[model samples]
Target: MLLRSTKAVFTACTLVAATAFAFAPRTAEACGGCFAPPDPPTVVSGHRMVMSVSQTQTVLWDQIQYAGDPEEFAWVLPVKPGARIEAGTSAFFEVLEAQSAVRIAPAIVDCGGGSSSGCSASFAASDEFGDGSAAPGENGGDPVEVLHQGTVGPYETVTLSTEEPGALNDWLESHGYNVDDSSQPIIDQYVAEGFDFIALRLQPGQGVKQMTPVRVVMEGGSVTLPLRMVGIGTGAQTPIVLYVIGEGRYTTQNFPEALIAGNLLSWDFATSESNYVELRDQALTEDDGRSWITAYAAQNFFNTSVFDANFNSTTLIQFYLNQALANGELSSSCALGLGYFSGTVENPCPPGEPWDSPACGSVEPGALDSRQLGCVGAEDIAVALDGLNVENVWVTRLEANLPRAALSDDLTLEAAAEQVPVNNILTAQIAINPEEACGNGVIPRTIDVSNVPGNRVAALMTTALASIAAALLLRRARARLARR
Candidate 1:
């Protein structure tokens, strides 16, 4: 059957990390539409979700690996109105993870020795929605309506809404999606709430390896995640990690905040991240079930040079011009040139080089370099970056260990009144001491510290005191002998 491509309405899922299924038959009824096929075998792993929000704009990136047949791989997500879906760079996630990852310091040990006069310590620390206009009554006679059809990366996406749950199921089944009766109740719930569903399928001939990160940009709202939908195809326990970027930190509105005890944190070895995962898991488990734990949060300013490659001189010029207009510095019809300076007749471009010159295309395609030809100057880039309002920003990372049972209801997030800045990168760690009685039982490698500053200072001071006392004793003896 030919699939109808058009436009409709619904709510969107927050950062539900990608949950995998084996396409098994359901023994019991589930809450939402099941995307898994019937009676399949073998459960798989690996699900991760990342989200970044700023003001009214939210960017959600989901990473899921399909171990099943490439043709059978499909993803269905619920989104709110005016969400624009796009393909995101995997590097962005990598950068964010590395920058925001928790780090642990090296364990310090005091060897068995006499009192030292001196001691030294050292420490080290480290998308817009598409603008396509939609007309009413685009789909013929079906309660399910297609709102928008677009391709993001390797997947073909269709945004849909339907008043009738049965029609929605039929529409999905006809389009080669596996929607069973178990998903009916969930569909009914979303339909009743007037939520829109986005169905994504790998394009024909595309393998799972071709799948890249998918980004969904939704309009402003308290960031909400559709837990019910996520729990549909997963096991009893699923792990979710989310990164939220905004003006401040965020917390779960429904669940209690899980706190990791700093006292329990310790450095295992200098190079290794110790017991962090274990501690994190323990914290999640201790917080009852389905609790949100703040992992990392920080406020940072990014250099404009980071995004230099994404914009060209033409775009930059236009961007500044728009800013000038918005700030009432220029009229709407004001003409701007590359060399245009405030009341200056001289052009800023070097010799024959004009601002509009082809040499000034954009930043070079590699690492950020202000000296690269075609790159916007540092000052101009800074101004442009300011327009984006990203200079001063907060990044909050939250994680949850959720059982399928806890995901029965949708999750809503509430921003924290005060955001704590993650001034240092935290590493997973367990405390270790050279003489500690209980630990991993593995003795840490010892280093010779006899020549260390504290040891040397102590030895020198002891020798000096001994010499002074000897001199005093000798002087007294000499005086007594002389008197005799």
Candidate 2:
């Protein structure tokens, strides 16, 4: 009974992660559950390093940097074929430079074929916190090498030929591994006998075209849009500002929502480093209660992106911000400082236990009395989406036309989705309750995942600290007994 109670507590505490996602954690079976793959591979490629450890995750609707709607807290990685990984082990990925990257992560199931603990994130980002891009196994600071991903699947190698020399050779050299055929970097695998890597069919290199006009189409209760560049820019013009003025229903707003969400994250607008505007409700019961995030037009090469207060029949994205500008939604930016999110912008260290006991937004770095604007136009879309009421209106896709708002003289969105391998690129799934906006107290659902690094790291730290404190208290109790 004690063990059962403890397990229940641990599981309950584990769901606070904002990174829960839709795509399963690339496993034949869901984490904590059993599954079987069809015609499994016989001689898989990678299956060397496998460890099994349980971890916990925190959940939230990350506004600026995480993902479009919110991010699901789960572990993800692209493996080279022939990897010998298992549960309880960590896998590492190489990262470039010390920069940040924003993404709306997709929840991918492993070779074992299992769903992730949570739904997919509409928006997921690394840079919003202002540190830098965190490789797969990073807790804080430098990324630790993850040799084995916790995902459950047969290890295999990619079986494709390419004219472009892969960075495999250089990667091997850096990792102190040989570049022989038997030593080729493993990418990913599904069937045991076959090998596969996330190959780029339409390579997004040579830079994504600019001012590329883009659009998306919608249907009854479903919207499917393919995103890609329309044209490449040779010359420069004053960066154009595209204000998106709509009601507080933004998440289910479709591709336009994804596009704006991406731009907001990439531009460093979500960080606490800038003067931030806010709107939030103390009551969790309020729908589209009040929250709209926006910023003034930057006189830089980049364009201005803002969310306005308006409503519409169907939420469609835009390539223009003229309507928003006409409505005069520009706020004052005269003396704004880098507004903080997650309360403390630079969390010298990850906040654990009792820290957020009162709540994350309970404390403040800037206006102590303020909260940043999110879902400003989030509710309107939520209502419309809920009205559609498909078994799953909780779905969205990636944007085609990559955005462009030149950087401030020294600022750059170094974090580009293309920078990550095509396989690493994914979209988050959002499931909002028109009935329960953000307050699903008992967010009762089964959590299914195997290898969540973020959770492992947090759990290790939390449990370790707790263990130490308990030990100290026990020592004191023994001393008292001896004295008696």
Candidate 3:
């Protein structure tokens, strides 16, 4: 049993999170869970979540970030009844985030009359919460009902339900959870909406240093994130990064959708700043701080280089071998190519023996037994691939910085009207010439605002004026030559 009590308010830290999804149903297995927080009072440093959706079920993997005393940590989620809890690993998010993050291609610079290395440069950047369980109060007079209690991964988890206004908080307090009075209204709101609350705490002797991630599985339930709960104990601007995998591209239905206008951005050779942030902030600001940018959207979106490199046969076998060695089940003399899928192998076993043999080579890579790779939590990869049908499914990544005011309403998602895909690699359209880099860098030679919406007329007018100015300079030169 675990228990703690402190005055600190409960904070559910999710990056661009708190929503529900529906997708194909599958057995809950291990996956990437919450992120590891380095310090207490975990601030709004953005969040990441993955949702696989289908008609009948939705599996969401969220990272929980909490920096505080291990025993004092408490995470509460307003999930639909019957939702199942499961353990997740950090590698799942690590791989997906690396594969999907935005990358900026280096600027194509033409340094006439000289060669300078600083002209062209490329840029790229890769950039959750709770579970716990406790002994249920035995007093028959308690109003809160303990629906389910069990251990999932490193945390002990418990699901509770009650209709009374303050019964749930009272129960949480009795269990040694430091529930603050400010959260009562939101807790009441969720309770009034017929939502069940789940509280997770680290199991006995478990500490915050270990990043334990968890997921909530909902069946046949169409739900949106509870943004109200996410706003508690957060700063004014909370960045939410959401990834949705489904049959087709998805977009936020309630909040306005914005796209980073790549054409308007430029790479500054002098400063090495891509100016991408300026355009992104400008677009979001135009939407009153309640917009989500569709950073990447496409079908069959996995990066073969990143995914295959991590999930290939060689790495899986190595991981299995490491596990075997640590468990003292196999001798260090065992070679890499040979592995036993199940049953303990004796140290210095006879080679090529019928009863004691290495069988890893005979099994196909895709068909390799997942049980053998349990030490690395590779099952979460299979769960994602199978549940989302990765090869044929659409993956969408949305980003937003929601001011506290915008978090009042839950965000809803729907299939995008246009299924066109957006590329994550942004190539700079504007080029720079190092010879004149300090003074706008030959922008007139390449800058074309003609294709830009609502700017065609201005582009043409500017072109005409430049042509007229050139002709005037030519006439003056001719007059001076005649006088000489």
**Cα lDDT, model 1, residue 334:** 34
Better of 2 and 3 by lDDT: 3
Q: Candidates ranked by TM-score, best first?
A: 3, 1, 2
Tens digit of per-residue lDDT, candidate 1, span 1-484: 0011112221344222234432121111112332645434313334445555433345566655434454455667767666667665433443344344444433334344432111221122210000021234677776788888878767788888887866777788887776655666766777787777777777777755424666666654346666676565566765566666544566777677777664455553433334555555677776556676776665542321111122222222233333333323233423334321111011233322435565644432332322211222212222112112343445676767667778786666666756555422332223344334223454444333334543343233332332332233334433544575
What is candidate 2's lDDT per residue for 433-464, written digit by digit as tens?
21121123433222222245333422233322
Candidate 1 CA-lDDT value = 0.47
- TM-score for all predictions? 0.61, 0.16, 0.66
| CA-lDDT, candidates in order | 0.47, 0.19, 0.51
Among all windows of 10 consecutive residues in model 3, the one with the lowest summed lDDT is: 23-32
Residue 394 of model 1 has an lDDT of 56
lDDT of 3 by residue, 74-173 (tens): 5676666777677765545544444455554334444454423243343533111111333467536666878888887777778888888988877787
Candidate 1, position 298, lDDT: 57
**Weakest ten-residue segment in model 1 by summed lDDT:** 122-131
TM-score computed on alpha carbons, candidate 3 = 0.66
Q: Judging by TM-score against the true structure, name the best candidate.
A: 3
